[model samples]
Target: MFKWASYFLCSFAVLASKGSWATLQDNNQTVCILKDAPNQCGSFCLSALDPMQTNLDAIERKQGVITSQLWALISRQDVQQKSLPSLDYELRRHTEMQEKHISHLLAVQSEMQALQKEMLHSILDVYKKLNAHQTLVQESLDKSITKEVFENRLEGVDKQLLTIGSTMAILMSRSVDQPHTVQNQSLQSPQASLQESLSEIGSEPPQFEQIGSRHFFIEHNLRLNWTMAAQRCRQIGGHLASFQNRLEFNAVTAKLLTGDVYYWIGMNDLGQEGQFVSVASGNPVAFFDWGYGEPDNLGGNHDCVDIAHAKMWDSKCADEERFICQSDNEV
Candidate 1:
């Protein structure tokens, strides 16, 4: 029995050793798989992220283009707003200019109306003066016609007187030679006296006197004011005597027989103060023979000149005095 037990124990020890070696090999393979798991997971995540990043970049580019377009539209709106105020200011200035032009036209119309009124008044005044002048001219014409009729009648009377004187003288000459008896002697004396009277009546004195180619008439019966004396001279186709020099004055004075009688001359100061002029000649008097302190402008109204002998004196025009008349002789 002891020999059989020893062989069995040796076989059991060999089997147990082979089973332990197989378990050690399995444990080593499991440890290697655990170590390589982190590397595989990292590679899978990297590949998925690449496509998502590309899509985000495209969205950002579209948003930038939209923002630029909005800014351009706002800039155009701002420019239009600024131009509106400038247009309104120009319209207001034009309206004011039109108003000023209308006001100026109204003022010119008013001034023209005032000037027309003044012209109308001046025309009325001229018409009044013309009516007064016409009345004076009619009165002067009537007086001249009456004076001419009286002069014609006087000429006829002078002719009748001359014829009667000549017939009486012829009758007296025939009766003187036929007388001697008492009745005849008385008749003869009266006839002689009649003849002598007839002879004296036939020779009449001349009315006018000639001096230095000028004829002068002295009105001894009539005395008149300066104005009336000038009118009388004109009626006889002559003017008042105007002396040119000392010799002419002396010649005129010698004809006057009446002493201390003042006679009106042609000189007067009717035109201006202290400026004596001739009425007949219409010239300044060169020869002056004024008496001492004569032209003192008495009563501030002495405007006429009168002469006594060879001396001159100033007198009022209304005073009564005889005047000398002169005229050019018919050639």
Candidate 2:
């Protein structure tokens, strides 16, 4: 027999003979019969009717495994519960950003409409003032009978006419880029005056072409980087050109030759990442003509915009290329 087995048997025999701290139980797990009497309680009480030692150890191992699995389940539940709030926050934030962007666009549109109405009212006032000046000049001419008196009156009328003309020019200058606003064609159109003003100032760039209502200086020969190109346009009383719609874009791009050539445009996101605006006016761009997989913002440095074959794409701002300039077109 094993040492432990012999030791256990000796201890049990000693305790049973002493008849101390032992009692009979419901099961047959008897350590020994009562003291000297038969079928009676004993001094030592142990569960001899329990499972074998090997079976007990296996049950213990199984219980440990079950406890570990339960703890694993509890830990996973805790992690998932902790992550739920963060995921919900991100979703709500994205939705709010989208709503704000849409509202801003609507506000800009309404503001533009308000500005147009104000301009029309101002123009009407200027016209009425001009007519009154004309009537005063005619009345002075009819009232003067002598040539010397008429000459003095005519000279005075000429000075007043010059003043009125200057005021009209200033008002007309502000309407160059507002193509959607109402204008009186019978009077002087702003477009004609714009051309005349450009002629008088002698600031029109060489080789500039008129496409639709806007004029563009598509400089295919001069290769310049984005910043340099914008500076060059400023030197010529213009900026890198910006297009407002597909028709204007197509009309201007149709003039370019077919090849791998690209031209710098005014659209850029330098002020804020992912928010493209005109480099000259610093306003959000109104139109987009992106190419396939365009605006990938490759290398995170593609903040400038370029156009080729009528399609736009984002590119590094420092790269040298051809560029277009426009003086009258702010869109």
Whole-model lDDT per candidate: 0.66, 0.76
The count of residue-pair clashes in candidate 2 stands at 3
Tens digits of per-residue lDDT for model 1, 101-143: 7788778877888778787777777777777777777677576
Model 1 misplaced stretches (Cα beyond 4 Å): 1-207, 328-331
- For candidate 2, write residues 19-70 as lDDT tens digits: 5434444343455443433123221222341345567789989999999999
TM-score of each: 0.37, 0.40
RMSD in angstroms, all models? Answer: 37.2, 19.3
Clashing pairs in 1: none
| Model 2 worst lDDT window (10 residues) | 37-46
Misplaced by over 4 Å in model 2 are 1-204
Q: Evaluated with TM-score, which candidate comes out highest?
A: 2
